[model samples]
Target: MGVTGIGGFFFRAKDPKALAAWYAEHLGVGAGPYGHWDTQAGPSVFSPFAADTDYFAADRQWMLNLRAEGLDDLCAALRAAGIEVITQADWDMPGVGRFARIHDPEGNAIELWEPAG
Candidate 1:
């Protein structure tokens, strides 16, 4: 049978328990023993970039993108929490969506997207 969807994402962390707690507090993720996060149904993008692509930091191998709603409020909340939120007008497309960037405590790149209505 064909693959249904991504089952989970596993990554290494210097402090697994602390990192899990951080994700739960900031991004509302990794809520259980196995780090199960329930998400709303929506379009999921799976694309590979070229080795020299400049979309994100060159030193990083992967970037995480999360679908969002009420992005303005969320970005504000994230900034108020002292988490840096990166936004640029050029990164947004007219019909596609708006995007903001942030990093985890471990310095992994994360993209937040709110698709256009």
Candidate 2:
């Protein structure tokens, strides 16, 4: 009838083991005995920003787009944990929903988006 949901996100990592550990410590994502992430619920959005994206400055090498169910809540959670969350006025689309950006320990930009749910 219709497409259901995303399976997984794959990206190149300079140090996959280290990068994976950073994500696990900061964003709560990485393979665990609990079986992946056991929080929140929603269909994830998968899209890529252009190579010359002004959305992320040139110093950053990669961009990650994440799908979150409670966008605002997650933003607060990340903020509370002392992570630098950057909200872009231009990135928010009318009906599609909103987007916020942040970087990993390795300085890779990650775009977190919440579609209308």
Candidate 3:
């Protein structure tokens, strides 16, 4: 599979469900199977940052996520590019999606998740 696109972006919020609902209500992302912005291809970044990692700066509010077509393909590309891609059984949400974790050059935790169809 080739790198086609991204899926969804998730982040930590004081009130995530509320915020998600807000985005759903206002921005309209959580509408249903199809959302306001539905990504059919590419990659969906699924990073979960360390509570203390400076990767997510104190003031900075977003984690940059690049979507991919397949986690395995993307991981292969990243590895070929000399990037460190971390994988574990616990990270596999196959029922939910497939996921991989890695950090940017700056040490921020990045999660790459692909949702189950």
Candidate 4:
């Protein structure tokens, strides 16, 4: 049988509990013991960038992109919480979607994507 979907994404964290808490609080991820999150059924992107690509931070090896809805409200909430959210006009595509960037407490680059409705 072919693979259905991503099973998990594991990574090293300096403070596992704190990091987990941060994800759950800010992005509503990694909530339970198994870090399982129920996501809406939709398209998921799977692509790798070149080593020298500046699409994300060069210092980091990977960036996390999350699918979202009601991005305007979410961006406002994050801003009100004092988190820096980055958006640029060029990053948006006509048929693809809108994009925003933010870093976690440990400076991991995260992309929030709101697909066209």
Candidate 5:
């Protein structure tokens, strides 16, 4: 059979422990060795952007997009926690989803998506 889904996402972090903690605390992402998350079944996107795409920061090589539910509530929580969350009206697609952008402590771009119901 072909590959089922993404197995893992490994990246280098300037401060792995701190970064992991941040993800776990704010986004509820699992952290530390043996950490794992059981995500809700849904659509996943695997597309490559053009070399000169302006959708995200040019300095970054890759941006992480995560599927989410309750977009408004999550955005509000993130804001309450003192994290800067970016939202643009134009980024929403009527049938696709709503989008928000946030960066890790290390400046990694993360796109949070809540698909339209």
Candidate 6:
């Protein structure tokens, strides 16, 4: 059978517990052994970029793109929590969506996307 959707995302973290906590506290991502997030139904992008791509940091092997709603408020909350969020005018595609970027405590790149309505 064909794959249905992404089941999980596993990664290495210098401090797994702390990192999990950060994700839970800031982005509302689930943490702990039984933590699970129930996401809304929407489009999910799966693409491989060129080796020299500058879409994200070169040192990092992957960037996490998450679908979001009420992006403006989320960005504001993130900033208020002392987390830096990066946004660019050109990053917003006409019919695609608006985007913002942030990093975890370990410097992994994460892109926040709010699809065009």
Estimate every model's Cα lDDT from 0 to 1. 0.90, 0.75, 0.58, 0.91, 0.90, 0.93
Could you tell me which 10 consecutive residues in candidate 1 have the lowest summed lDDT?
3-12
RMSD from true fold, candidate 1: 1.1
lDDT of 2: 0.75
Q: List ranges where model 3 is wrong by over 4 Å.
A: 1-67
lDDT at 15 for candidate 5? Answer: 96
Q: State the lDDT of candidate 5 residue by residue for 11-117, as single tens digits.
A: 99999888889998988887545557777888889999999999989998899998998989999999999889999999999999999999999999999999999
- Tens-digit per-residue lDDT, 3-117, candidate 1: 7677788888889888889888888887866899888887888999999999999998899999899999989999999999999999999888999999999999999999988
Q: lDDT by residue for model 3 over 30-112, one digit each (tens)? A: 57653346545433445676667664466555555433456788788778767788787865665577767665544545567
TM-score of 4: 0.96
| Model 5, global lDDT | 0.90
lDDT for 89 (candidate 6): 100
Show the lowest summed lDDT stretch of 10 residues, model 4: 30-39
RMSD to native, candidate 5: 1.2
| Candidates sorted by lDDT, best first | 6, 4, 1, 5, 2, 3
Cα displacement (Å) at residue 19, model 6: 0.4
The TM-score between candidate 1 and the true structure equals: 0.94
Candidate 4: regions farther than 4 A off: none
How far is 115's C-alpha from truth in model 5 (Å)? Answer: 0.5
Candidate 3, residue 47: how far the Cα is off, in Å: 11
Off by over 4 Å in 1: none
TM-score (all chains, Cα) for each model: 0.94, 0.67, 0.46, 0.96, 0.95, 0.96
C-alpha positional error of residue 66 in candidate 4 after TM-score superposition, expressed in Å: 0.4
> Pairing residues by index, what is the TM-score of model 5?
0.95
